[model samples]
Target: MAAACGLTAAATMLPLVLGGGSGDGARPGGRPLAQAPPAKAPGAVPAKAETCTDPEASLQPSSADGPTIDRIKKAGHLVVGVDQNSFRWGYRDPATGRLDGFDIALVRAIAKNILGSESKVTYRAIPTNQRIEALQEGKVDIVVRTMTVNCERIKQAAFSTAYFQAGQQVLAPKGSPITGYNDTLKGRKVCTATGSTAYDALKAKSYGAVFADTATAQRTVPNQLDCLVKLQLGLVDAVVTDNALAAGQAAQDPAVDLKGDPFTTEYYGVATKLGNDDLVRRINQVLVDYRKGGNESPWMKAYRRWLAADLKGITGPPAPKYR
Candidate 1:
């Protein structure tokens, strides 16, 4: 995903420290934090009438149902998992020390509809690999970490409708002769994140591009300023990564440029724990509303504000399949 709004770890850490308690505040030592008092057996009637009101009263219309929504209502807040390192999609604001990005806008919209306040959102910065695991373990209520929804991931978690469309692109020095996927990569070394789909796709194509398993393709460069630094320094020939990320790298350094068209398409989705239909439905409803009336909602406004400026010729939300 492109780094439009900047969701950085240092930005998210401020909220974590202010909120207090260990991450998630779940029970320690492999036990529930506080077990509920023994309750009457199933089919038994309650002794007193329940006083809590339906929190969904304020939510927009939706047919989907699940426990994720209920949990957020009960807790009076929404916990969203996101990536801090990716520049446009998510990153930290050095000035405010808070997490904000295109995905963060969606999280705020959902929080406003559910909690009636945007401040109800609790941002959790997670590594790319931990996005699904965090949701599965109940460490977060939702994962907005630019996750791609595929059949395999579906088995582990439910997904909201697609919100972004992306594809793989190669990053190389500005004046390199390599221009497209068909170019000879036999002797060129490519840097990509370990276990990333980009690696698999490149390998499947038998491109003969050497692979460097780094934590983030952006960091594989010798310095933070230029992804082409390695190539300039003769450390590597090119960097293979997503087009959006490649755009970020090019924007950061004039010496680098994206080569050719994207190699593969990737759809971005919000991830929830497996079987958490309620939360997923609620989020889907928000997306539906945002895309309604042929109007750009606040979420899209934020997205455009941060993303459009950097990705020239790219504007508005992704297509229906991606939205």
Candidate 2:
């Protein structure tokens, strides 16, 4: 299959960072940190469990400006939290040193709608575990990373309507005995990004895999790319992550490929600090226009340019659901 997510020629040839170098997400010979506290920040009211039946249903789209939008406009730029290590989703181009990918394209679209210039935006690299913290701490105005929309997450953050549909899947070497997400992985070393849904899924049912973070072996990493590194170096037998992201990893290495069908249904969305309904609603509006024009829509165009080859058979973006 053709490379998915527009993996740059340079990205496919990236040298392996063997020593757990900076920004590589490797933590060789290090122990996983203590469990993080709850997703809600101190003094923040948690969302009632009953209110989150449909996490993907968001406020109706509105172009009217609010305090959040006014502040970003006044500052003349939008601040976006993104991932720079995910090959085809939000990675920085090694050749140009500029962020490019499906997520980055959406960030630029939001900036253009808010500030009249896509370049008038600052990108901050947010780790998978810190996406909520960054938003609650006001470190970033919005997070366009491939964040999943879930009831627990909606309790801590506001999400726009679902932008993309993805699911948990396994990625392993070309000829590994590890079948899909089933018993083939029993007793094997499987890697996943810390605080990711994949980690949660594994915790619920791992088929006897040794995936927990330990003092001797750090199975969890700061970013998903680190899992790929571990797989390449024989440290981990398999990697479990969003298939959307796993597709990019497979593009980077011909030896590895997605092993099975996605095991769970999930939706990707734009996230803001809890109660940032204005920003959330505004983002919904941007997405409304982004998903227009059928196959010619910006959402479809992005898929064709960045994700179609590997994540095939998608006709269009997910329809928006309003609360």
Candidate 3:
């Protein structure tokens, strides 16, 4: 699961160091955190000439090495952009100060497949809004964070076949009256990460809820974990994020929990820059092998290790689909 002891200490000490440690809405230095200008939410991609219907369908699995593969081999290590705060998916273990989780395991699998060494990787902690930017700028070879595949994103980046399935859900304190993504949110402040699908959902239909942090001096934070912080500090009444991630947040803090069932279906994919067909195909091939072995598959083992405890009922990784 998580680094129990270290996470416990972090839960106790993080708020104290970050700002407000209590639910009284007090911030450090007696000044509220500044709200950054809003980033475009990474919801469904806009319609265009190349609009897609099946974003999960990717290039056929291939072991072939091409330009992107050659470049990565020449570099001798994989540069992966990931989130260091999303527990169970990807996070730096406070106990050992090493990255560990489901996504980290997949990154290591990719590294071992491409570089013949799992340890030969450099992780760059990227925020939600910058996933595509990092890849397009050649800052990272691939992004394995819980990035959802959709029509719009495919236009900007190539993706491997679906690896994990997730959906947006609500997270709130245990005793809160905010039941779910319903009218109960009327007039209540909700928190979501900037550029996240959750923000998009709220923007499309708020149910009388207030999500624009600028109006409340609480703009959305870059990381999903930051939403958990705001929830702890009473800055927002509920948090809307991926249920897979909300499970981790609930595990990290017993005071909060997922408030409702998932509202939409989405798939997680490993994203590479556009035209990185070689790398994308190679990753698809890796996923093909990674999904084998049934119950003993590496994917299932990872799920059991990190996710089963909090997010249950997953039988296996999503079947890979090819274009």
The model with the greater TM-score, 1 or 2, is 2
**Model 3 bad stretches (over 4 Å):** 1-52
Alpha-carbon TM-score of each model against the true structure: 0.73, 0.85, 0.85
| Model 2 lDDT at residue 198 | 89
Superposed on all Cα atoms, model 1 deviates from the true structure by an RMSD in Å of 14.5
Tens-place lDDT digits, model 1, residues 1-72: 123113222333433211233565352221100111222322322211111221111223364545656667
After superposition, the stretches of candidate 2 with alpha carbons farther than 4 Å from their true spots are 1-52
lDDT of 3 at 169: 80
Best by lDDT: 2
C-alpha RMSD of candidate 3: 10.5
Poorest 10 consecutive residues of model 3 by lDDT?
A: 30-39
Candidate 2 structure quality by residue, lDDT tens digits, 55-137 = 78999999999988988777777777888888779987877877799999999999999888889876777778888877777
Clashing pairs in 2: 5-306
Check candidate 3 and list the clashing pairs.
Answer: 45-152
- TM-score of candidate 2 versus the correct structure, residues matched by position: 0.85
